[model samples]
Target: MAKRIVIEHCSGCDKHSWGTKHDEAKYSSLAMNIASDIEGEASVRNIKLEVEINPPLDRKRFVPKKSESLQHVYFDKEKKKDIRYPRLGAFEIHYVEGTSVAKVLFSKIEAHRFPSRHDVTSALERIGLYSPAKDEEEGRYMDGDDTHRSSSERSSHNEDFTAVRMDFLTKYVSPLGYEGEEEVKKMTVGPPRAPTPEPEPEPEPEAKPDEKAEEKAEEKAEEKA
Candidate 1:
């Protein structure tokens, strides 16, 4: 069966786009795994893999395609304006076997949950296909820090690529409808913000020994008189 996997790398702050061809062997392996998983008991042989890469966009942030769902939207209540966000980087893996077609999504999240397929996620991380927004966040913390390194240097770090895979097989690809497909996995945007620390209590002032002594003396004198 011949399969085509389209890895779409959307534009990020870096304004660069990448495709599956960058790492053909890795993508091929991924395709095989997906095929086997989808086929189940059925035999899969003589599989052909094709990868298509999309060009980078000029703008940092752009509206998502109609088919792609928006993960988050920032609305300014005070300004009464919508805060535009940069377009997120993503990967669209399409698996086609004859007339049947299946699709999946690797979306960039602010804080991506651990992917269901560690191998798939690791494969993507091995390459430079990651979210630029995540890179920027790490860069902010990396500044003046000795423990952290640049995004390029951390290519092998699976912890950095916080992207979730949207399994389209359930809703879009399955011929039997969404009954048998696994539930879609959810990815968190970022870590929860730390709570504000409460203020410390003020120290109590100490009484002066001189003032006490003076009061005592005055009292004694009054009693004597």
Candidate 2:
């Protein structure tokens, strides 16, 4: 199956502080590292980094402007101070085998740890891009929990939360990877079986005329005798 990895930039960062040297370097490094990791993966067929040059305004929060330029303005407090919006700086990993796509959105705290190649690989592993068992080990190491737990148990506890986040993001963001509807299998119905035929009635036997004639002749002969 083919894999596609998308590294998305923060729209708020681009709109507000794109020209700033610090912001430029931050996003650039993030994009470069993600692209490198995706390209390094043999399973990845396509790698793309999409920046929101013209992000939509549907979710824009209107706040009173501090300056007198306007009474109210669209405000993104999270992205105003170089922090990514809750949904921004996300990675969308798609697999051709399944309809559902895996999504990862890095918090401000997490983004700081993503500069290294190891962190990039670890990020992919967390989003289920690599071996699941290996990912579990890495998760344990990262969490600093040495207790040995069964795969199912760990997955139920850890992976289940990831699944819930995936569900929430997919429902809210509804990324391009998940736009198409899943193909539904069609079921065929056969014609009903023909009913059984009924049996025919038996015909009645015809009486013999010779037996009547013999009886008459015998009666006449007895009368003459």
Candidate 3:
């Protein structure tokens, strides 16, 4: 059935809505019609409709000031500066919204060790990115008397981390660039199952004495008598 409703304009966002900014009468009427439509559609589809009004933002990329809940602060020793990064969990929570990549990444990741965002970040630090501090002691040392760290020491540390990142990217991520639909289908399906063991053969029973033959000989003897 056709339904008519007015779309009200908002001064703050310059957006039209059937929600908060709308006239109270229009808002109520709109809510009823929308709810009715959703209920009918949900019944037809055998699914429930959850309508959220003015849902809170899960993550915000930029803010007037820094908040721990919003971003992560990391110090970059080489640059002699602090870097701001999205908290991995918050980043993924934002990234997964309205994206096909979520399913692809999730399905692929399910077969691997990176279940939690922390695990994924750890994996990335080990093989995806070159983190400044390898351990707590080195990090503290770098913040203090880093001048004592020799040129060779810095070079060796960077080289090792860079080698790990490059090797993993080259050996694994780069090759994935060539993956087509079939390859992706296989990858997303999950790890292969182990082979099933064959069933053992049943043993044959031992032969029994010929009781039928003995009965027949006795019958023949009785008949002759």
A best-first ranking of the candidates according to their lDDT comes to 2, 1, 3
Candidate 3 residue spans exceeding 4 A from truth: 1-115, 118-130, 133-201, 212-225
After superposition, candidate 1 runs with Cα above 4 Å error = 9-50, 55-91, 98-205, 211-224
Off by over 4 Å in 2: 11-21, 43-101, 109-115, 132-225
Tens digits of per-residue lDDT, candidate 1, 1-225, equal 655444443333233334411333333344444444434311122224554444232233433343233322334455555543322433344333444545454432422321134333334334423333654565521211122455565433334222322342322223222232333322323454588999998888986579888999999999999
**What's the TM-score of each model vs. the native?**
0.25, 0.30, 0.19
lDDT for each residue of candidate 3 in 1-225, tens digit (9 for 90 to 100)? 222111111122112233523233322333344334334433433443333221222234322236644234445555655544322111111112232212122222234211222223343334422243533333311211232454445433322222223333333333334234234334434456788989898888988979999999999999999
Model 3 scores worst on lDDT over the 10 consecutive residues at 87-96
| RMSD of every prediction | 19.1, 19.5, 23.1
Poorest 10 consecutive residues of model 2 by lDDT?
180-189
Evaluated with lDDT, which candidate comes out highest?
A: 2
lDDT of 2 by residue, 91-190 (tens): 3322222233445434333543223233444565666555546545644322212233545555443332222233323332232222221210011112
Model 2 alpha-carbon miss at residue 102, Å: 2.2
